[model samples]
Target: MTDQSAPDERGAPRLTTREAAELLGVKPETVYAYVSRGQLSSARAAGGRGSTFDADEVRALARRSGRRDTSPAGSDLAFRTGITLIEGDRCFFRGVDATELARRYSYEEVAEWLWTGELRPGARFTAAAGTLAAARRTVGALPAHSGSTDRLRVAVTAAAATDPLRFDLSPEAVLSSARSLIPTLVGALPTLGDPEEAGGGSLARELWSRLTAEPADAPSLAVLNAALALLIDHDLAASTLAARVAASARAHPYAVVSAGLGVLEGPLHGAASGLAHRMLREAVDRGSAVPVVADHLRTGRRVPGLGHRLYRGEDPRATALFALLEDVPQAAGALAAAREVVGTTARHAPLHANIDLALAVLSVSRGMPADAGETVFAVSRTAGWIAHALEEYGERPLRIRPSGQYTGPRPPQPLPGLRTTP
Candidate 1:
């Protein structure tokens, strides 16, 4: 913690390590553990405060921890990232709490910060008229029932074709491309609601109307916006890695985003939310989580959205989403069902809900189609992929190549002859 020796920027009353432990009836070491779990927030030392926690938050976490235990996360990736940190149950973007960042900024603001490491308050992204028209024209050629990701892939390609400077990979050039392409990706989609609503103030508001015909309420719209911000980046996720590899080979920014999009729908990658959406819908349909969860276990199928490889406790994104979701009247049943799913599954393991489940809850509550979570993921992850591309662009060309440890037949085996007609 930095020794600012000043009041916390948030102005919350702070507690020192010993004071917090005494209040929580735990050791100072356990106090640090609480920060790691993200159950508590800490601030730099100031006014002889040393490192401290918000008094009210620590009290709340103390009450909660008395009821259930959270396990510390186990494994971590070796890849270095200045963009995000997945520590224990929490995520941080350049050391700022991502959940908190989402609560405070628009998705466009978050994406801008990720790309340039500078906060631009009230930043807005707008696509050029020609590019939007071209992208929409290309996407219009697809079947009416085309999936969101498919439409997006086509839209990106068309946008690329229209950009005369796509080959100019300078940082300024790439940032300009991203600022246009992101909005274009949204604008290209056929609006399912009022065109005026889809033509909006914040990117999240614009995206909401494209996603569903339902009217956008302030509370629910806030949730959507926060989801987008929270998902701006993860440390070297599969799709981000793919984007970096492409960038390392000098691909243009649009192509880097396309490469990321290509890897997003795989089962082991970004498709978990779709599965979770389906499962949540079933549970909501049956009006109970019991049978749905039991059936998965009985069939030997893992319950979707229950746990995450990246976290051993709760997903902080889910925790934040659930907090915001509490204010949305339409989300009550879906949120309850999500909690039930977690409660039902936790009897057997330390499994806890992840961001996929949070997104599933959002989609299910908003009356979006089953794959809507995937759509949200793809759009949000575009920012992350581009961030990775920017980082890779600064590294040595093709620097990610790794030699294979062959476990196949010995290398000295004689080469087989070319086969004649068999």
Candidate 2:
């Protein structure tokens, strides 16, 4: 039980190291170890003292020490999901190692496996004629300089408008829409590659054509395909959360994806790879990451893609991508630049390379623009958003809503003008 007497800033009593240690049945130092391993989050105690853990979070962690965390009846904020599990700095999709899935299957296959339990070999997703046409028509009207995600937002809404059965929330209906909508989003982008390859075939190939005019080689396409599979989901990310909220409110599948796209536009989320892309490109141009890394640090900017909040070590996605890039001769310089970036930044703080740096390597080597990574992320993560929507559709409608904790001034205060109306 938590002490109700001393509430922390979050309106609940916070746990000290000793309390958390006792709760977890571990030594005080072990509590800090969990913090470092990203198993738990901590903050400084009041008055700049030692660390403090959220009482509810600590209890939740303790209960889930063996498996995944599950909230009690009243803890509506804690949720349950079976899609993606991030354990021991590794990512798994449906209990299968994600990197392995990325290796053995294509993006469509992995997405299919996530949506359904079965993996269909050589699965192909084709956009509907009407949906693709509508999305293309809508995206064409966007400003010339609009980012890929902006075009995607417009395309999804238009795609939804074209579908008469979009409101059907049944499993089969949602699945059909997902299969069509994903490719439709890719088809909406103006072709930068062979027009023949624009609408279908490999999703990575379709997206590649849109990102740059550079020809897609086997090895490079391999890397891009794996990236899409690897990025399919990451367990209730900001965008996924938004998508789930929309689904909880009984929004249709297209609207659910639109909600996710809204959150993905944030710099800290979808645009992260764009930042890393620019940084890695500058390092490649300079022929050394030292100055570029120095410029970032000297200007008080983070060396983009250097770290992730979830992993205490190298992000597994980065490790997988870097291994694949090693086989591509075109990626050597950009890959080296990425290494130097890690080495340079590690000197001041031991932040390891994250997926953004790996994505930067791909975009820089492939001649894709800075925003190219954002497009890859949006298209890839669409599957995940769909999966979340599917899950939310099974739950009671609007059950995810949380009541606000009122902290504002009491209502009925005198008006600013204090005018007495007759």
Best by lDDT: 2
Name the best candidate (by TM-score).
2
| Tens digit of per-residue lDDT, candidate 2, span 1-422 | 22222467658787888888888776777677667545578887666667888888788677656322232222234456779989799999999999999988999999999998788999999999988988888899988999899999999999999999999999999999999999999989988877876644789888889988888888998999999999999987899999999998899999999999999999999999999999999999989999999999899998899888779999999999999999999999999999999998889999999999999999999999999989999999999999989887887677665566679999899778866999
User: How many pairs of residues collide in model 2?
Assistant: 0
TM-score of each: 0.80, 0.83
**After best superposition, candidate 2 residue 98: deviation in angstroms?**
0.3
What TM-score does candidate 2 get on C-alpha atoms?
Answer: 0.83
lDDT tens digits, residue span 223-333, model 1: 999999988888878898889889989999999999999999897667889999999999999999989999999999999987777788888998999999999999999
Model 1 has a clash total of 3
Local distance difference test, candidate 1: 0.84
Separate clash counts for every candidate = 3, 0
